[model samples]
Target: MNSNQTEQGIRTLGVDIGGSGVKAIVLDEQGLTITERSRVKTPQPATPEAVLNAIASLASEQGEFERVAVGFPGVVQYGITKTAVNLDPQWENFNLGDALSKLLAKPVKVANDADIQGLGAIKGQGVELVLTLGTGFGSALFIDGKLVPNLEMGHHPFRKGETYEEQLGRAALNKIGVQKWNNRLQRAIANLEHLFNYNTLYLGGGEAKNINFQLPESVVVIPNISGLLGGIKLWQN
Candidate 1:
C-alpha cells in the first residue's frame, strides 16, 4: 500500500474476488483505506455458496458500510455470474449480485474480475481496454463511460493449440521464456487491437506489474488498485 493512501476517507468496502483469495478494503470517501483490509483463500470449487460465504466473512471483519462491490472471475449480467475460468465451472449460473447483496444486507454489484482492475486504472477515463495476465488472461472493455463486462476474448483463438490465455497468461510465460512470452503477448494485443480498436490499454495482474519489454505506445501499466477501486465504483452502482 502507498503511504498517501492511508490518509483518505473510509465509507466504502471494496473486495476483489480472485481465484486465489478474496481481498477486502475499507476506504474513506477520499480514498484513504487500510492496505491490509482482510483476505482469505477462495474455494477451489468456487460454488456460489462457498464464494458468498467467503465474502460474508470478509465483510464481517470490516463491519458495516454503505455498499459492497465484489469482483467475480466470470461474466456478470445484472449480477448473475456466467463463468469462472480458474474456479468452479458451476459459477456459470450464479446469481452473484443477489447472493452477495443478501449476504451483506446492502447494495451489491458484481463485475468481471479484470474489469475491477481496469476500473481502478481507467475508471474515469471515458474509453479504454484492459487486459490482465494473471493466473489466466482476463479482459474488460469500456466505451463512452460504460463497462461492457465478460468479454471472454481470452479464450479466442490465437497461435497453434493456443488460446489467448495460452499465449498471454503468466502460466504460459513461466512455461516459455520471456522472449517467447512477449511474442505471444504482442500477438494477443494485436487481437484486441483488431477486435476492440481501443485507443488506450491498461495492463495489470501480478505478472504485468513487472513487464520490462517495450509495450505498445498506447498501453499503460496500471497499478493493482484498479480492481479495488473499481469495486468501490461498483458498490455505488
Candidate 2:
C-alpha cells in the first residue's frame, strides 16, 4: 500500500445509528472490519443525548481508533441532521457529528444512513440507487461513485396517496404481511426503475431479508452491514 493508504489504514470507528439499534465496529483504512460489531438497543425516545450516550458507549468498547464515521437514519448535511422521520423530533437540526466528536474526542464525519450504505455497495460505474427498508424507508443516489446527498425519496408519494415509507418500511412489512409487502416492493421497484433509469439498485437495511420474490436483474440485495462498512468512505477524500 502507498503512504496514504498506510496512513488511512489506521483504525477507524464506524457507527450506525438507526431507529431501533445503535451499532459500532472498528475498520481498517480499506473498510475491512477489524473488530466484531458492537450494538445496543436504541434508547426509548431516542433523543440526541440518549442516542449519543449509546453511541459513545459502543465506541468506548471498540478499542483505539484514529477517527470516526457515522451513518444516521435521517437527512444529514455537514454533520447536522436536517430531518428525522423514524427517530425522535429532537434529532432534527442536531449537530450529531460535532457532538459525537466532542464525546469521543475524535474527528467525525456523518451522512444519511442509506448514503453510507450506497457508498459501501456501489461499483462506481453508473447511476446507482440504494433503498433501505428498515424502521422507515431510506434512499440514496449515486453517479459514478459521486453521492447525491439527502435524497429523502421515502417521503415522496408512491401510491394510494401514501409515501413510499408507508408502504415499504418495516412497520409496513409487518402490517401487510411478507407476501403483500413483497408485492408492493416489486411494484415500487418498477416505478423507481422508470423514475431514475438507474443502472443498478441495491436493497439493504434490516427488512431487506424479508423480500421473498425474484428481483430484477438490475437490483441486488446487500447486507445490512453495508451501512457501517461504508463509513470509511466518508474520510477517503
In candidate 2, clashing pairs total: 0
**Top model number, lDDT:** 2
- What TM-score, computed on C-alpha atoms, does each candidate reach? 0.85, 0.96
Clashing pairs in 1: 8-32, 9-28, 9-29, 9-32, 10-27, 10-28, 116-227, 117-227, 120-226
Tens-place lDDT digits, model 1, residues 51-102: 7888888888876577767777777788888877788877887888787777
What tens digits encode model 2's per-residue C-alpha lDDT throughout 30-94? 88888889999999988999999999899889888999999999999899999998889998799
Relative to the true structure, how large is the alpha-carbon lDDT of every model? 0.76, 0.92
So what's the TM-score on candidate 2? 0.96
- Measured with C-alpha atoms, the lDDT of residue 183 in candidate 2 is 93
Q: Pick the candidate with the highest TM-score.
A: 2
lDDT over C-alpha atoms for residue 138 of model 2 = 94
